[model samples]
Target: MDSSDLAYDVFSRQCSSRSTLEHVTGRWGALTLGALHDGTFRFNELRRRVDGVSEKMLSQTLHALERDGLVLRDAQPTNPPRVDYQLTALGREIAERLLALIHFVEGRQGEVLKAQERYDAARGGL
Candidate 1:
């Protein structure tokens, strides 16, 4: 069977879904998506909410997510030209899943930190 006959496999290096996964899971992308999940926001507002993401990086992330159909950019014609961004339906679904993973990781940080400490100590003598 050829690729068309098979499901989209992210494990395949040539598959396009892998890139989308990166956009949804990367540091800035994940943060941006998660913040947007709460509500729509303008560029600066989103940057503030995401925190620590540089303006350039956030702009690139938004552009990528928008291209992936996971985000909607609403540009209004006004004195200053307001531009707001919100997750698309697909974006919402993706964000929901990402949020679950984020919460899970956050809740387990204590255990993760302990493991990290142990790992560092084990290698300290090396």
Candidate 2:
């Protein structure tokens, strides 16, 4: 295809903006990336750290990250197999961005709470 044709064809389709946002800002993905920021973690450790993630969801999310080449999964041979997960370079970059987002939320938490309260009061009165 010509360069302009390729550009037009690529731009013709709707981008997966919703899924992309969901992947980055999803509850599990956000928590997982934040946890991995510290260092590598085993499956159980990750499960514990992420608070509300179910075993199945954790597994599925990890699989997605691994498939995207953002997570490095190292499986060790043992009586029971041991798997450790660490962020790939790309993952690390994104994790840093996530960290910044977390910080932003934390800093504005009080303001956000006040805004929510105002909204609730207004809506409830209406």
Candidate 3:
């Protein structure tokens, strides 16, 4: 059954929600959303904020988020043609939750690193 026939089953292979979940949680997607959550930003500004993301990948991520209705793109006609990106209401809500997870990860990074070291030690060091 399709997502509409159900409750947007993320576990279903054919469910569109699966793709949206991936888009939001993917490396670039999550970072991009977090960066945009700070405020609206121009393309280059966002690229700089996201760090390590290539122009092409950032463009694709933005397109996917926009298609999912989680991001808004405002293009202005001007001398240089400014294009800005920001989170929509739905995007903001999702981003808030994502940020909570991110903060939790950050807060536990030391513990996570210690666990990783223990695992690596047990494995005789990778």
- Please, what are the lDDT tens digits per residue for candidate 3 over residues 7-97? 7679989887999999999999999999999999999999999999999999999999999999999999998899999999999999999
lDDT of 1 by residue, 7-126 (tens): 788999998889999999999999999999999999999999988999999999999999999999999999889999999999999999999999999999999999988998899933
Please give each candidate's TM-score: 0.93, 0.83, 0.94
Ranking by lDDT: 3, 1, 2
RMSD (Å) per prediction: 2.6, 3.8, 2.0
What is the clash count for each candidate, in the order shown?
0, 0, 0
Instruction: Give the per-residue lDDT digits (tens) of candidate 2, residues 20-114.
Output: 44565788888898899899999999999999899999998888777766789999998799999999998899889999999999999999999
lDDT values, one for every candidate: 0.95, 0.84, 0.95
Model 2 poorest 10 in a row by lDDT: 3-12
TM-score of 2: 0.83
